[model samples]
Target chain A: MAGSSVSWSERAVRLLRRMNSFYSAGSSRCQCWHFSVGGMEVGLVPPAVLKQLRRFPEVFSFKEEKRLELNPGLASYHDRSSAVDRVLQRLREEERFTCLQGWRDEKYEVMPQFSDPPLMCMERAATSLFGVKRYGVHVNGFTRQPDGQLAMWVARRSLSKQTYPGLLDNMVAGGIGSQKGIRDTLIKECAEEASIPECIAAAARPVGTVSYTYEDGEGVFAECQFVFDLEVSSDFSPSVGDGEVHQFYLWPIEKVKDALVTEEFKQNCALVVLDFLIRHSYLHPDTEPNYLELVVGLHRPL
Target chain B: MAGSSVSWSERAVRLLRRMNSFYSAGSSRCQCWHFSVGGMEVGLVPPAVLKQLRRFPEVFSFKEEKRLELNPGLASYHDRSSAVDRVLQRLREEERFTCLQGWRDEKYEVMPQFSDPPLMCMERAATSLFGVKRYGVHVNGFTRQPDGQLAMWVARRSLSKQTYPGLLDNMVAGGIGSQKGIRDTLIKECAEEASIPECIAAAARPVGTVSYTYEDGEGVFAECQFVFDLEVSSDFSPSVGDGEVHQFYLWPIEKVKDALVTEEFKQNCALVVLDFLIRHSYLHPDTEPNYLELVVGLHRPL
Candidate 1:
């Protein structure tokens, strides 16, 4: 697929910069106060969140200069989880935050790092409000044609989905809830979203991750998606199972590359596809001037 | 083939952190002054380099407070290159920097980013002294065995080599000179170092990159390696063409993973192989707790 007058690499980098805007120097969110718990910086609190947080003086603190700290007195993980949950429930009832309207009743772990012990857990919808790190697994489904060319399976999100409705997504994607592990979530999502059998889904390979942080009206979103690539037989097709995905289309890799710069795919999902293109040697250094930048952008520290 | 007491993921992260020690919090080099060229921050100048730069007032200016800027008066690329070259030549003759002992006639472009127009060119050996970004091509030579298992071809550097002598290296690697392009250099290096034919080398897939910045006693080292994965036919074996490599070993994937923690490979080459493992699903999120961190560390901003 031929790129536009402006190379696809340039457009891809622009999209990545937008996704990582919060971390860019001189961005307004870069001025946001640090959100810390147990003296560990876990998230970023925007100005609006900071103001609202001031209302819960016993639960949140801004006493340490430009930092918002959870009450260190909430010693155990359960105590901290309950303390924050109480505040979120009050905010939901008061309709103080719009993000709470899409609450999935799911919880995400809050920790300094992914491998670290959880400091607390927060509602899935409320994660962006606190700018806590969110983790998910995204599967890149593809198959090899008889002509020896590769094609990717792209999913159009159901119009009824709560977030990013009707947008293009990977074949299977789901957040890793506090109660679930990465692999379990991945395999479960594959079967539920794409109707792929557990045996085939189990063969999906974990191929590193893509991470970025950006801030919007809702709050700040810092996320990392564990990426996987699954190659299925030519005759295999993924049909919608749970209706989260409206439709699945198997398109040539060339067509997928053309769509990448259009921003047609969900932002993070576009990154997953971009990583696939690079790994598969489609977006090469010889032709893509922004190759290195794209690589770094996809793997930013969460 | 088993990891030692420590998990391979932890050891890999520890090694990556060591390679990227300069960017970690509280590192001495983090306190170094920014080295700017043509109004762009292209490098980092440590205190030792700063002290020596004071000898050439006409070319370098550090009066800006915690920033080292090449004389703005040297406007054109040739002018800047010549001025910097004069000073470097002086340093070489006066034996001011021990790193110059391994001087390479090759020159590296000084730029804010790889695709940008270079402000000037500096001797490759002096890049570390100024902490400029240096890029090279590293090929992960691997092949699929008849049993469906994978193995990697690892090279042992000649003892006479100037840098990292007698250490393990990738099958093929070479720095990208200012005048040569990425693909040409990669193809050339593959042929020169491993005696790979042009047709075979042309099939190498440009997977991605591994970048890091570290500061040692000599100076700040910031570098990025353009990574390529070349899956040679099982019948094809790479032979040493250049004396830079003393021998080559084709090790099982499991053995390669085991050696990753020993630090037996050249620091950067180990990273290239580790990246290979992740890309091919050998190091997985299901088992590697540091999966995301390893992904981020391998692609740090240079």
Candidate 2:
């Protein structure tokens, strides 16, 4: 939430920024499990899930266990997920959420217990996993002004998109939609969102992630958005590489600040840009009373 | 809360920084309330407290209510609090806990609901109110290097201090004790800790705040430390005026980074300086994969 002193666009951005943050208790009752098809104790499934799981004994198991677990005897992850997918397909029909979107052949790694060995390699469809955590990256494409100032590249998202259509977005953003690498995601997003060549897109750095947990009536949304800052040459011009972006705009830091502090840009973009400003020394702790608060508040403790 | 990459002092600082942030659920089972000596709905007092309040009906009231409350019709704030103070003084005798400190005649405002227009103002002896929220200011003293680099002033608290004695700290830090304003606290602390003259201290700019929430068996601790950046001249040297500080040192950004990454500073001070490093462009997103996460994670949502 934003304070009254914050301008309009900034308020919207602050709220949007809250999408990946921790505010109150999440509404989810389902547990999040690991790649090994083990149950994540943090999540609590509704009572009805017991009856439903009973119907998929081959795919799930509780038989005298502490919590639900994926049948360890499954042949492969593909076999297990496809079985779970079929259940979800039927669930979609039963629940009548035809408008559901974001399903993909690729999967997102959930409950990443380890980064090196990846102790539990849990994978699920990019869609149908709303009640758990997800990951993505948002990049800020910028250039140094002649006076040594910073100017940013902003993308006007395509109106046809489902979320925040026609609103402003980061220069590049893409989900960790599959079992893909962070650098690969940045390169792919850069090429699609801003027409940056793959080689140049690969130069985009992976900074860190911004995380949040929010839940509505449907399910809880816990996400970690990795943030990036890619400095482009002064002569660089961005074209809409994919149809997802309507157009691109190059604006100085002041104009970008106007957009953010006044609520003109899309919501999450506010968080990305605000981070940019603070890290770049544009927003000083002395000048902004909430500076340290925003800095420490953006990430969740591991 | 510090990651494995963070240093020991930095990790300690991060933990101290968590005292006021509401990332996880607070320990209090009771709901928080306001207005006229009433039960603090949130905090769970020991069962023995009922007898204490019963002894101070003139100052405190919980005769029929479940929560704590102040006598609404008290003649003056002092009259009401003095009555309550007697109860606490007597409770100390019963508990037999020695060496309790911070019992100043001053008070701190509890539950600042609005960025502006604070809702309920309850002042209490600073010592006895550790379980509640408190406000303070922390200033980062910096100077420009002749080679276009940034160097900072660091302070070491006196061994005689009650908290984190002999530990590294920001150049200036002081609680918003009594009715002191944020700026006033900064100026006062600067002079005391680093012997920076009042006029020079006044030149400091107000940065944002750093917040966190923490709890132990004793009580829940919520704190907001207003941050500042004061630029000093190269020729200046600090002479400790207050007994609280033992010494001061001037070091460039590189040494400061070593201290932070190696965990040499006090816990909250680590966060303050880490924010400094990122904002000053010492840590860039291109090089640090966790840049956005750190920025967004620093501040808690309102």
Candidate 3:
């Protein structure tokens, strides 16, 4: 539906393939070493990053199994957290990586799974460098027209943003930083990103998640977004808030689908929007030949 | 949350593990040979089934690379289909397998993906013998009470049914026989299984799909289900039709969650219902620790 020569499904698959580059078979990224902490494999370390870790012998270890792990002597959560933070701060001072240039003070929990107690917390911006599974909440805000058609609320990221500046995004999205709760993060993001009140934001239903892992020049990004769908009233309109967004538009679902394959949206945000379309039945199996593929691709192993 | 001793996430993970038994690490099933057709790997063959196929030298070929393929001499789709069906028919007559005893005069398309041109078609009942992928359509019929609570219509399979007899099921479900389209099968199943009218059944929205592969005593079942959600008016109630269902019950969402872990519903059908619960947010990420795992489990690579 989006391309004249290629079908929408092919375009969508291409987008997902881009987001899951690391998982591509036979790629060098597929050979990344497992990153473990406190006996739990929580992240992936590419060969290049592993080479850099060899320098921090006191804090890092390259075991016989080819795994990159923190020093077993750093037992307590506090000790591990500070040990990793020190290495990251020194790397930032040395200007060792371009991703470190966008460093934020935010912290993220490092664990095998979201519910498990974190072995430790690390700077949010550096999580990808270690390939730790990152979590975020994304809200699909939509309204039902009187004719029963659906329209989604789309946001334009601020030009001043560190990543994906000026690109299209979901109406509400924010990382689930350390000590943060999922729903509370969703509600807070809805208010900060789109000026939605707490009562309205509370209505955002936890639909599911969209997960994918890709490696760029910076590091590997393996992320799982807690997806929500909020059916806002037709009379409501969102205004930009927190200066993170430059503009807001209420576009028909068809327009959103067309934009998905054109790179008009931020890469991962497009995936979140694609998930919303599938769940709402805008992309039916009959029209989209890759319906099942698209569904499975959106939730590839994180 | 069904288990008092274990969390809902654990129970849900156990259910998914059961459905995806063949994918478990280091299991004998993980070593099943790739079953190929026309150079494409469309199915999987366990050692036991591979041994049986070797008896029919003219129909199946066991290559030096360990791949089990339909004889390449059967060049065309028609030739390939008839050749495989012949072996299945003989196996049925010889009482070689229990699954073939449920043989219906139905056929299923076999290919690498759902949208691809079929390499061949095989007896629906005997497909699992070669671990070929099978497809079906499942509908989640529900109604919103005046108080805003959601309830679902659940069917009890007729005692005379060949599979999972007298067990709980979705309001409507049916295998996608060759030449039948997904939405058409969904509408047809809705009318036949729940006595829902065409006009109402047409409202069923194709939300997404649930896929899994499991090995059992008979063989391997690799299945993908096109899932639909139909929200009926509160005044409408379903009655049994076609004698496939013995009775129907309108259950609250919570009741359905409880039944999922109890195995009250057929194994695969319960997965479809669990998917509905997740899409509708009856199972929140906060309470369901296995939320991400459950989401990924439902859409495992087929």
Best by DockQ: 1
Expressed as tens digits, the lDDT of each residue in A134-193 for candidate 3 is: 999999989999899999999999999998999999988999999999998998998898
Return the DockQ of model 3: 0.85
Chain A TM-scores of each predicted structure, in the order given, are 0.95, 0.78, 0.97
Q: What is the alpha-carbon lDDT of model 3 when measured against the actual structure?
A: 0.89
Worst 10 residues of 3 chain A by lDDT: A23-32
DockQ of 1: 0.86
Q: Could you give the CAPRI-style class of model 3?
A: high
lDDT of each prediction vs. the true structure? 0.90, 0.61, 0.89
- Residue A256 in candidate 1 has what lDDT? 87
lDDT of 3 by residue, B98-201 (tens): 99899998999999999999999999988888888999999999999989999999999999988899999999999998888998898888888888999999
lDDT of 2 by residue, A102-178 (tens): 33345565443213222122334323343445667888899998898999999888999766688888888887754
- Candidate 2's displacement at residue A187, Å, is 4.5
Candidate 1 Cα errors over 4 Å, as ranges: A1-5, A28-30, B1-5
List the candidates ranked by DockQ, beginning with the highest.
1, 3, 2
